[model samples]
Target chain A: MQMTKQEYSKLVDKKSPPSKKLKNCIFAFLIGGAICTLGQLLMLLYEKAGLSETQVKMAVPVTLIFLACVATGFKVFDSIALIAGAGTLVPITGFANAVLSPAIEFKSEGHVMGIGAKMFSIAGPVLVFGLTAGVVYGLVLSIFRLF
Target chain B: MPQRTGHTLMLPSKPSVTGYAAVVGKKEGEGPLAQWFDKINEDTTVGESSWEKAESALVRDALALALDKSNNPPSAIDYLFAGDLLNQCTGTAFGLRDYNIPYVGMYGACSTMALTLAQAAIYVDSGAAQKCAAATSSHFCSAERQFRQPLEYGGQRPPTSQWTVTGAGAAIVENAGPGPYISAVTLGKMVDYGIKDANNMGAAMAPAAADTIKTYFEDTNTSPNDYDLILTGDLARIGSDLLYELLGRENINIRDKHNDCGLMIFDLKKQKVNAGASGCGCAATVLCSYVFEQLRQRSLRNILFCATGALMSTTTSQQGESIPSVAHLLNITI
Candidate 1:
């Protein structure tokens, strides 16, 4: 009557439903493409507004982050991501949500220990690795320039 | 007289459930069992500023309602067994602190309802207490941040993952009542099948549930057909299937008589609850509402209520430890 963990896991896998990865991927691609296209459209709109290249470069992400924050506050981003999957995740909007989410969740604990400390809980790993990779790339480029 | 039959405790006194109440949040209020709940809070916060406090309020409201229905004062209750999914069982501690009742905080994760109920019945059956109350709650918002993710975090839950029911249930058990009595009880041992994936809790807890149910049947010399129902707490779709498979191996076919509180609470097609609803509240609220109602109506005369719990903390899981689970069974008869 007793089964090993491996056997039990197999049984569990057999009984449990499999994830629809193909369907998820298709949804992710469509929604991700749509999000990127929206970003491109925003860039074009900013250009039409006669903003400088630098200003437009900063404005695009700022606008997206602002929208993400607002959507997160209204609890709409999670619903969107439920269908969009990684579509909304692999963008700047996802990062905004990651940061703002804990900020909102932990705010009950108080400003100091709650929101301030846990604000980056989800996005903290990304920041650490991203900054480390940037530094490593800069170091490699600087050493190559010396040659 | 309390007679011990292997792992089952035969309660000859048959401590009866006198009062019961279920309180749930907005999401659960929209579920199929909405009408069954005594009170449904449209606000997830339950008018509280924090989710932890709100969860406490759920437990308090449920216990208060149950006591109110039983016409029992707080001083009349000798023991109160309550617990929740929060760390250190803060929800129960805070919720019942002001009630001035002798409180016993319990921790069995999702199986808390059955654990509390069985203990309450034991206390009453053994003549240690004339009256006892069992209560438990689980808040989705509180559990999400503590166990899974932040409320606003944008991520997809796996198909096997179950949603925590934001609700609470309470019942008052006494030596004398109008029936629907606790006739027997079986407390399960920890069973681990090395399920490391926290998302697939049904797989982790199913082994324990199977072990407990099989043991109960063996101890009592009974079969699935002997009872009107075999109700499991919060096993949902995947765990229930696994339970069937595991029990099938032992020639114990409960598929015909079985129903999980998780599956009964929510409509999976519309609720987006993946496999089904989970948490301590899943079983607690269902038992306190639907099952008790059915018992009262004589629709379900005899039943076995088994609540399953996964005993793995976040730290243990993060340290690569497999989940060990338990299931406590209570045989109730009207």
Candidate 2:
């Protein structure tokens, strides 16, 4: 009862089981590698179909996004992600699922305010920071080139 | 007559549990305590279009079942204390809207079950009402969308993370009946041990649970051995251990007599619920069905049911404030 918040948190940390980081890493690596290989296969297939390099490059991600959206709709993505950990999450498909899920979830709240607004609830930070970083990097490169 | 003993109130009027019912979704129906529930809807949504509606439907079904079992019409109930793990307790409000009962909306998070029961018993014991009802619910989908993530969002849960139960429970309490009575209650103090992790709710809630249980025991001059069971709401694996450790620090051992509703409701290993089941429904369903059945059958004589809740919103967690938790205790006996 006399224990401070710091002391109690320490006790909680000591008592609570740690996440299986190494196991998760291994699973993530294997599953993520598989997804990348599949993407490569899709690219090779697109190239064989006589598509331009740029078209193949664009086609691969679109295909991956389509598949991810379907999986999200079918509600099987989370099951796979459970075992896959960051495997499913680090890919483009993960971003697609992240966007699509909230849209589907908030569909009941109506389209404009619910789906449109909340579609980016989870992935909004990534886009904002991603674009910001890109702009900053481009600015930094231009500044260096001016010399 | 109601008598105050320290922080606990002894309900000498014996607010009797006349009827109790639990309604659960598909996942809960597949769980270990499935047989105990009154209704097990194979559809998680309960044929409702949205997750929020499903949760409301669960609350409605649970209350209807309890009322039917009580052999009392809705008009007979004087007051209804109900809540759920939803924004503004909308699940309870919408669910019971058609019932036309005088409603007292509660917000105890997962601890809403015990909180409602305590309030209902107090109302009955104080002669404010001849009959009252306590009800609460939580939907996995609704809870996830509100508190965590969208249903299809792929994210791994931490080991200490709990699965919110998609269920509801209701109990009708009367001034007198063939008794499994509400004998006493110990209202908890808000206790925060500076636990900031939202995923690790057990850690956030354990201190309050330990505090309330200790207070109840001290107030009643009773020990862990005095009760057949010391039931905690949703302190799953980690929180339950922390509670035992906290109590043991004061040389009060409840490990032998303790059983958490979280642990009892789900088969952790097979269900893959990480720590255990949580949410208001976790405790509510287990208590209304299994515990109530045991009490009625005279299998368990006395129980100290303490339901703990992590009183933190997503906004509070994002604001870096620690989860302040409360646990409300009820002394239920046959």
Candidate 3:
């Protein structure tokens, strides 16, 4: 017989208890916002590095992957994520972080099949989309004489 | 694999006229034993391997009860769709293999039960098979032994801890049922929180539940008020509250009808289930014993059981990465 907190709460009828609800929400909000802010900071760094718009876009993902790899190596990302909720996942940083994290951890198995292949596991969709979008953009530019 | 090609069979099962089924494992006079694993501490003498076997035994019995009540021969079932917390699906495969039913192994963490049930219902509804049994099993001892270490290997559980339940549950869905039928299902969105601790799966699964619940309402055009109960697999105490807050933001007030199986299964004071148990078996056993029984008695008209899972790997966990979660919704009309 599985029981829930609500049922337990009802059984005891203990009102005016510490609110676990508020704590979790605030915890998720603050940490999640912090992660996004960090991404913004990275973006600023990319611009200050004197990179062009295209280069900055590319570098941002690279930086995210690197940061995620380091975080994963240090084993800190998941702990922070437990508090932040979706705040860690919504940004482009999350995608890059996911891709690189797996590659670095799997490196122990082998290089060719392990690090090389697994690193792109999560990023495969991004590459497909980027290539498809690039081709579409190129075709449109050629037709419109924009590039 | 028995592949039968024929016309689609749509059972005109109304939500109001369908009967339901249920099964529980703990024998009579064995009070509160079904969830004994939640109370197990790091210093317990029980070996992890033994716990795994015990968990498997419970699940096997529960599954047999569900199958017996459904009145379907084990051989007539098309596939045994199942999963568990153990590496390589040890409990599900071992507990059910002897029945000689074709197995379609799946892994979606704790949310596996609803995912399997939803898929099983689809097979029956689409005329893919006359009967398909979708079942999942989980054991805290087995999970702890495999994922972490033996219970006797005392270790401090962090604040984000969620106790794994030692239990197993199964459900049978048939095409010619004159009972509760699965109406629709909603798969959860993959959501990640940068929390790297493997101890707290409940928190990891919250966003997945929020995503699926929101999607279910949007897709089905059904509000939380429409169902008698809106249950989540193993969100436990913390995750359940998290889900409530998330849903509240969307103006989907489900506090009154919503519940978590992890939190509901034991006496927290006497048993002292730290955090709460969230696994494949948690929700499976609850649905089979509590929810389905209510449906059979016509005490509840409709139910939306949303099982949630954290799709994380040991490598990902050791790498200090956040967990990605998925949730699946099974709408049962009685």
Candidate 4:
């Protein structure tokens, strides 16, 4: 007889322990706070890099993507991300990190097709929208100024 | 014995049934949502009692509406597939139990409604069950207390933050029916877009919705124009725009019929639901109460309901990890 998804879910649950609720909560608090600290450090680095405001803005996201790619290669980002929750994603850097990490992790499937192409798997559309919206906004602002 | 005569046995064309449903929490006024409508009104924050009370009320209201339309009773329901965005699914569990129907509790973050409907349809089609009732619920106070903190906590929310609505919705699917039936379901493959901020769930979930919608069209050989409506769970405003952009890349235009239940549930100006609403209950309440009613009234026919979810754990969030999301789609045909 074929087992249903519900039945399969139940069977899987039987193998796992229901306990460890407290330990999980404690770990989440500590790890999540630590991740936020890393984000704060990155923000400081962006300010102290002695670059102009515009360059700092660009560098922040770029630096995050680089770090995330490295972390993805080392298989350490997912664990850290798990604890940081939304703290890691609030910044623009988090978005870059998320995009590049997946590409690096999936590189094992095939670098040219997988890592190189898929790295933008999630971030591709965001960049497209950002660029498109930016151009539209600029055009609208210019038109308004002419009036 | 002589050979059989002219009678040909015709097999029933594989029973195809699919449709969408939604339910809303507030009945015109009288909840936390009511305060959003009138600035002069008192209740700024939802109370603890309101959460518990609203969950039960919404469950009853949504279930009654669904049953009246489906013409099915509590007894006819073979299984009650239900869940909520509350702690341990308290609202759904406690509320559903009052009906005295046996149900299996499920949790898939915000994707509960679509997931439950998909599971129910599978059971009916496989002959494992004749009828099933799928339901999901959410309450603002309950969700805040469990997921974040108390309503009085008064923390500043990020721009991407979405308000949680207090509501519930239910759908009933049967083996035989003239009503719309569930046709097909596609479970999403979890995608982590590295969104560490919980505030902007729309960005995190939009990609999942695009991925699932693309896959569904591919797997079923159905084009975007084939359906009258393609609804996403909680894309709200920002995510809705993102979804449109993503689908455009595939040469699929969903601009006309595409809508987000999160954006539809409340009036932003009146209700002050910032960035609209999220959570499993957001789609559940809207689809059952509003969308299902319209469908039954013959306003809608074919609908593709895709519910999206952020599956990040508190542990992952604390670790500054990115958010992973999943989406599930149910094709409903009238």
* DockQ per candidate, 2 decimals: 0.76, 0.82, 0.02, 0.02
For candidate 4, the per-residue lDDT at B143 reads: 71
Distance from true location, Cα of B159 in model 4, Å = 2.4
- Residue-wise C-alpha lDDT for candidate 2, range A54-82, written one tens digit per residue: 99999999999999999999999999999
Task: Itemize residue pairs with steric clashes in candidate 1.
Answer: none
Each model's lDDT: 0.94, 0.94, 0.66, 0.66
Q: Write the per-residue lDDT of candidate 1 for residues B213-262, one digit (tens) a residue.
A: 99999999999999999999988899999999889889999998999999
Regions of candidate 2 where Cα sits further than 4 Å from its true position: none
What are the per-model numbers of colliding residue pairs?
0, 0, 18, 42
Q: Worst lDDT window (10 residues) for model 1 chain B?
A: B148-157
* Model 2 quality (TM-score): 0.99
Judged by lDDT relative to the true structure, which candidate is superior, 1 or 4? Answer: 1
For residues B19-103, write the lDDT of model 3, one tens digit per residue. 2222333321122434422222232212324555565555566667667777767887887788887788877777787888888
Report how far off residue A48 is in candidate 3 (Å). 75
lDDT per residue as tens, model 3, A1-147:
123435423422221133255766676578667766776787889899888889877877677667755765666765555455455555554565566565654554578896787777656778899899999999998999964
- Per-residue error at B42 for model 4, in Å? 13
Task: Name the docking class for model 2.
Answer: high
Q: Each prediction's TM-score against the native?
A: 0.98, 0.99, 0.62, 0.61
Better of 1 and 2 by DockQ: 2
Model 2 per-residue lDDT at A87: 97
